[model samples]
Target: MYGKAAICLTFVILFLVSCSIYIGTVDLRSYFFPLLQSPPVLRSLCATGRPLRVYMYDLPRKFHVGMLDRRSSEEAAPVTMENLPPWPSSSGIKRQHSVEYWLMASLLYDGQDEDEREAVRVSDPEKADAFFVPFFSSLSFNTHGHNMTDPETEIDRQLQVELLEFLQQSKDYQRSGGRDHVIPMTHPNAFRFLREQLNASILIVVDFGRYPKTMSSLRKDVVAPYVHVVDSFTDDDPLDPYESRATLLFFRGNTVRKDEGKIRVKLAKILAGSDDVHYEKSVATPKNIKMSTEGMRSSKFCLHPAGDTPSSCRLFDAIVSHCVPVIVSDKIELPYEDEIDYTEFSIFFSMKEALEPGYLVNHLRQFPKSRWVQMWKLLKNISRHYEFQYPPKKEDAVNMLWRQIKHKLPGVQLAVHRSRRLKVPDWWRRKR
Candidate 1:
C-alpha cells in the first residue's frame, strides 16, 4: 500500500511540472508576439497620423507677396498672416503660376481651425522634415521681364542672385546641400538666371519640357498643376449631359507653338470647318476667357494640345469645368499622378494619331455617349483636388502638393543619409 501511494505522488508531481511548463510557454508567447508586431504598426501610425513639419525661412516680403504690392525692399519685417497681401484680382493668367505665393501664405496662416492641414509650419529647424524657400520666382519673371530684352530684366536677375546669396549663408542649406530645400519655379523661365545653382534642390515645376533630365526628373521634382484660369463649374449636374451639349470638341487658344506643340497648328487645320467644333485663335483677354469658359461648359470634350510646354493650364481648366479632356501631349507630366488616374476622366491620343486628318474627330465622334457621361461624372468628382485657395482646404492643390512632397521625403532622407558618409558623391552613377 505504501509503495502504491508513493507512485501516485510521483505521477502527480510530474503532471504539475508539465502543466507549469505549458503555462510558461503560453505566457511567453503572449508577452513577446505583440512586441514583435508592434513596430510596423507603430511606424505606420506615426507616418500617416502626423502632419509634415516644415521650416520656412524668415524671408523678407520682397521675395514673396511683396512683389504683388510692389513693397519696398527696405521693409525688413517678415511677411505675417496679418500683413500678407491678397493676390491681386487683376492678376490674370499670372495667377495660374502663383504656386509659390499660396504655399508661403499657407505657412503663414495661423487660424485655429486648420486641424486638417497636411503640413504644419514649425519654427525649429531641427524638427522640420523639409525646408521651404518662398521666393516668388514666377511673379518676379512676370513682373520684371515679360519682355526678356527689357532693361527691367536685370531686376529679375538680381533677385535670383540675392536669393542664392541668402540661401548659401544658411546652415540648414549647407546641411543638406539644398537637397531638402523646396523652391517653386513654375514659370518656364522663372529662375533662368540661376537655375543651375538650384539643380540639387527639390524644384516645384509644371513640366520637364524645358529642363534636361539631369536637372529635373520625376524621381526628385514635383509636377504641380497650373491653377486653372477658368472658374470651376459648380452646377454641372444635368438630366442629359451628352444630349444637351451641342459641340463635339472645343479648342480656343494660340494655334502656333514650338516643338511637340506644332501639333496644334496641324490640329487647327484638321479640325477646321467642322460644324460641331469651335477652334479659335485667341489671346487671354477677359472677354476671351469668359467665352472660353462658356465654350468648355457646353462642349462634350475639350481639346488639350501641348502649348509652349507639354502641359498647359487649359488642361486643368477643362478638368475644373467637368468637361472631358482629350489630351494630345506625348510628354506631359501630371500632378498627384501617384494617387489620381488620368485615364478615368480623360482621353489620350498619340501625336501622330492626333495629327492624322479625320482620324482624330472620327474617333471622338463615335465615342459612346454612355462612356462620355461616365467620364464627365468622374471629372466632377475629382475636380476639387486641383483648386488652390487661401485658408487652404483639405486635399486641395496646396495640401496635395505638400502630400507629394511628403512622398518624396523617404527618398530624400535616404539620399541625405547616404551623402553624409560617402567619400565620393554619385558613386553609383560613376559605377554605371
Candidate 2:
C-alpha cells in the first residue's frame, strides 16, 4: 500500500512540473514574441534596418552637375564626388526643380555612419535593387533652353537622344528593359523629346497633371516635393499664433497661368478690395521671394492655387513657413501620401468651392481660431519632411524619397517578372 501511494505521489509531482514549464514558456512568449515580429507598417518604414542598395550609372557631367558650369562638361572625365559643383544661386525658379541634384548627392554621400542612411551606393550592378540614371533632365531643359521656341532647344533634344542610345546599349537596362531604372524628370517638359521611349522606367515627378495615365501613375512613379524656395520660418513660436498673424489670407505670385491655373485670375478678381487679404500679382525674384517670406510669416493662411500643373513649389514653401496652407487644386497628388496625412495640416477646397464669389473668404473668416492654431502646430512639426539638403538628415526630404522608392519596388518586381514569361501582350492594356 505504501509503494502504491509513493508511485501515485511521484506521478502527481511530474504532472505539476510539466504544467509549470508550459506556463512559464507562455508567459515569456507573451512578452518576447512581439519584439521579434514587428507590425507590417513598422517593417516597411524601418526596412529591417537596411539601407536601399542603388547602382548609379557613370554618366557624363554634361548630363548633371556640368550644367551648372559649362567648363565641367567640356572636360573628358566624368563628375566625381570630390568635383561635384554646388547649384548656382542664380538658378532662380529653376531651384524648385533641383530634386534631381539632391538625390544624386544623397547617393554620393560616403559618411561613416550607415545606420541612419536610407540609400547606399553599390558598385556591383548585380546587387542593386534599383538602378539610378543620374541625368539631370530638369536642369538640361532649364539650361539648354528657357524658351522652347528658341533654336538652342536643339541641344536639349540631342542630349535626350544620346542618353537613350547609352541606356539601350547597357546589359543592366536590357535585363529589366528599364523597368527598374530611376529617372527624375520633375519638370513637366524635361526629356520632352524622348519621354515616351522611357515610359517603362520609374519616373520621379512633381505631379501627373501633364502625363498620360499610361506613361506615369501612382502605381509606378514617385511624386516628390519641389525644393521649397522660401526660407524656413525658424522662430515661429508665438503665445497666440492666430492673433499674431495680422493678415487673414495671403497670395502673391503670377496671376496669369495655363489650364487649371486660370482659377488664379478669377480668384484675384474676387479677393480684390478686401482689407485683410493680401492678394497681389508678382513674379518669383530675389526681392519678391524675400517679401513672400515675410508675407507668409505674418499671414493666417497662405493660398496655393494650381500653377501650370495641379501642384507647385508654393505649397511646400507654405509648409516650411509654418503658414497654414489653403490648397485649391482639384486633382493634386501629394508626395508621401501613404505615410503623411496632408489633411492634418492643410485645408482643401474643390475648384468649384474656391471659385465661388464669397465661399472661400467667408469660410476662412469663420474658420475656428482654435483649429487653425492646431494646424499651425502640426505644420511646424511636419515641415522638416519637405526640406531637401545634403548629408540628408533623418526623415528629411531625400530620405523620405528613398523610402518612397523602396515602397514601389515590390510592384516593380511584379511587373518585371510578369513581362519576362508572358507569351501574349498585356491583357489589361489591351482591354484599356
Candidate 3:
C-alpha cells in the first residue's frame, strides 16, 4: 500500500491532469521584465553591474507535465518587474545570455533529448554565475514508500549519497571563473551533489515555511542558510484601501483538512455588506498552497487563515505580487518576527476576533490602493530579502563554494557529472 504522501503525489498528478489549474498564458512582451530580444536591464543589482544569470534546471518529478512555469515555449510579454537601464557594454555577453533561471530548463525527467541532458548536466567549473534550482525539496527523497530508515534494496545509495552530501557538505563549491555560482534546489540530493562539486557555497532554500516539523528536523542537518518566500507577509493590522475591493484569495489544499471554504464564506459575508467589497469566485481550495502564489498576486487581497494552525504562504506571495495579505490565523509564530514588523507589512485578524461580523472587512476597507501601491513597493523591496535566491541575494553562495577550491579534501574537487544520461530518468533517479 502506498503511504499518504505517495497517494497524495499520485492525486496531484491525476488532478492536475484531469482538473487542469492554470493562471493563464504569459506573453513575453509584458509578464517578464527583460524582453527576449533585449537584455533585461537592472538598475539596482549590485554596483558591479554584472548581469545575474540564472539557469533553471527541470521541474519536480510529480508535477512536471501540469506545471506551466517549466514550459519554456510558453511565451510571455516582456516584464517591467526588474526595472533596469540598457547597458552600453558589448552585445555578446549582454544580449546573448539570458538570466539562467532554472524554471526555463526542462526537468531531467521530462525527456531524453541529448540537448536537454547536456543542459541539465553542464559542468560548473567554467561559465555561468549560478545554476538555478528553483522549487527546493529537501524531504522529497523519501522515495516510493520507503523512508530514510527503510531497508534498502535495488538502488545504489551512492547516487543518493552524492545528492544528500552535496546539500550538506558542498556549501563552498564555486564554478564559472570567479563570477558564477553553482545553485540547485534545496534537497538533500542536489545539496549533496553541490557539496561534491562545489563546497562552502551558499545553499539557499526558497519556499513556504508551513512544514514546521519537517523544517525543524532538516534545520538540524543544515550546513547552509535557507530563506523562504511566502505568498503573503501580513502585519498585525492588515489594512485595505477604501476604493479597492476587499477579498482574500486562497487556492485550496484540502478543504476537508480544515473548514477553508466556510472560513472564506464567513469573511465574504463581512465584506459583502460593506461598500465595494464584493467577493468573487467561490472560495478556491487547492491541493497545494504553491498554486495560489500567483492567484493571490492577481487578486486584490489574499485570505490567509492558516490551514490547520499557522501554515500559510499568503504573506510572502502578497508582497511579491504587490497585493495585501489578510491573515486570519493567530496561531502563527513567524520567523524573524523580532526583526520585521508584521503589523506594518501584513494585516492580521485573530481567529477569535476574525468572524466578529464586519470586523475583518471593516479593517480591510481602511486600506487604500494608492497607499497599498506604496506599501507594495516597500513590500517588494522587503520581498527581495525574503525571496529565496536561486543564486542567493548576495555573492555568498558562489563565494562559499569558491573558498573550497583550494581545499585538500575530496568533497570540493570540482568534478562535474559529465556522463550523458537519459533526461526523464535523470530526474526520477535523483528524486528516488
Candidate 4:
C-alpha cells in the first residue's frame, strides 16, 4: 500500500504533466533569470566583495539537532557522538557523505579568520541577499522516513508542514515567496513531502532523480557534494598506493537495489572472480567501513554504479582513496562540474558501452601507466573540494557549495522580482 506522501507525489507528477503545455509556451528560464543573456556582474555590498549575504534562520533544535540525539548509557547499545579519524560525528550519520551534516556545516561555518568572501552569512535578514533555512532535511528524512506502511510515523510530513507554515508567515517569505531563499535537499528524498511547495525556491540537491525530468532543471538548483566517508590515503599511512594495490578494480556495496541500481547485480555477475577484479557485497557497519576503505585504497579503480539515486558516496570515496573512479551511471549528475572537469581524473562508461562484453575492462586497461598516475595525482588535488571543514577553508567543500549558490543569485533575484510584479492571488499562492 502506498502512503499519503507517495499518493501526493503521484498527483504532483500528474499535475506537472498537465501543466507542461502551459509551461512550454513561456520561456521559463527568462522568467527566472531576466539577465540570462548577459553575464551576471557581482556588485559588492560591504567592503569585502561578498556577492551573497545569507541570513540563516535560527530554527529550533528539534528540526535539525534533536533527531541526532544519542541514546543514554542506561539504554541498550548506546552510541556516543565523537569525531572519528576521517568523518566528523557532530551531525550524526556514520558516512562522511552525510548531506545533513555537510549542509549544516557549510552554513554554520563562521569563516577562516573573518575577512572577505563571495558568500557571507549576515545575522540580520534585512541586510541579506539570500535567506538560508538550515533544517537538516536529509537527516530528518533518514531518521524518520522509514515505515512506509504508516503515514503517522513519518516525521517529514509534520516537519515540512511546520517549516512551510513558519516560512509562509515570515515577512521575508511574504515579500518574495522564498524565491531568494536557499534550502538544502541534498538527499533525494529530503523534503519530498513538500517539494512542490518549495520548487520555486533555490534548492541545494544532489541530483534530479526524484523529480520528473521536465520539472527538474539545473537552472534553479545547486548540486552539492556527498560528505566522503573514507579516510584519505595520506603520507602517514605505511602503504604506498601504487605498490600495495594488487587489485585492478574493486567495489563493495549493496549489490541489490531498485531502479538504476539493477545494474549492480548484472555487473556483479559479469565481473565477479575475474582476474584482479574484486566485487562483493558490503554492509556499511563500523567494521565494514574500515574494510571498504582498505579495499578501495588497495585497488587501481573503484566501480561507481548508479544506486536508487543516480549519485552515490562511493565515487567521492574513490577520489579520496586515490583510486581511479569507473563511473557506469549514465544519468549521474556530478557536483561542481563547472569548476572541476571530471573527465580529467575519472573514467566514464555509458551503461550500454559498459555492458558490451569485455568492453569496460579492456577500455580501462588501454590507459597507459603514466596516464593512470596522472589521473590519480589529479584526484588527490581535487579531492579537497569534496571535503567538509569546520570554519570552512578557502578551497574546501563548504566554500565550493557557496560558490555554486553564488552562481544562482542572479536567477533568484530575477525570479523574486518577477513574482512581486505578477502578484498572484492569495488562493492561488496557497494552492501552489
Give the whole-model CA lDDT for all candidates, comma-separated.
0.86, 0.88, 0.38, 0.73
Model 1: residues >4 Å from true position, as ranges?
1-47, 71-73, 112-115, 423-432
For model 4 the local lDDT of residue 17 reads: 64
Error of 3 at 11 (Å): 70
What's the C-alpha lDDT at position 427 in model 1?
Answer: 69
Q: Return the TM-score for candidate 4, rounded to 2 decimals.
A: 0.79
**Can you write out model 4's per-residue Cα lDDT over 295-414, one digit (the tens) per residue?**
998888999999888888888889888899999987888887755668888899999887777888887767687788777777777777777765457667776777777777787788
Candidate 1 weakest lDDT stretch, 10 residues: 38-47
Q: What total of clashing residue pairs does each candidate reach?
A: 0, 0, 87, 2
Candidate closer to the true structure by TM-score (higher is better), 1 or 2:
2
For model 4, the stretches where C-alpha displacement exceeds 4 angstroms are 1-48, 70-97, 115-118, 150-152, 236-243, 424-432
The residue pairs in collision within model 2 are none
Worst 10 residues of 4 by lDDT: 37-46
Model 1, 154: alpha-carbon shift in Å?
0.6
Candidate 4, after superposition: displacement of residue 244 in Å?
A: 3.8
Q: Arrange candidates by TM-score, descending.
A: 2, 1, 4, 3
Query: Please, what are the lDDT tens digits per residue for candidate 3 over residues 363-417?
Result: 6656666766665555655554344323232322222222221121122223222
Question: Sort by lDDT, best first: what order?
Answer: 2, 1, 4, 3
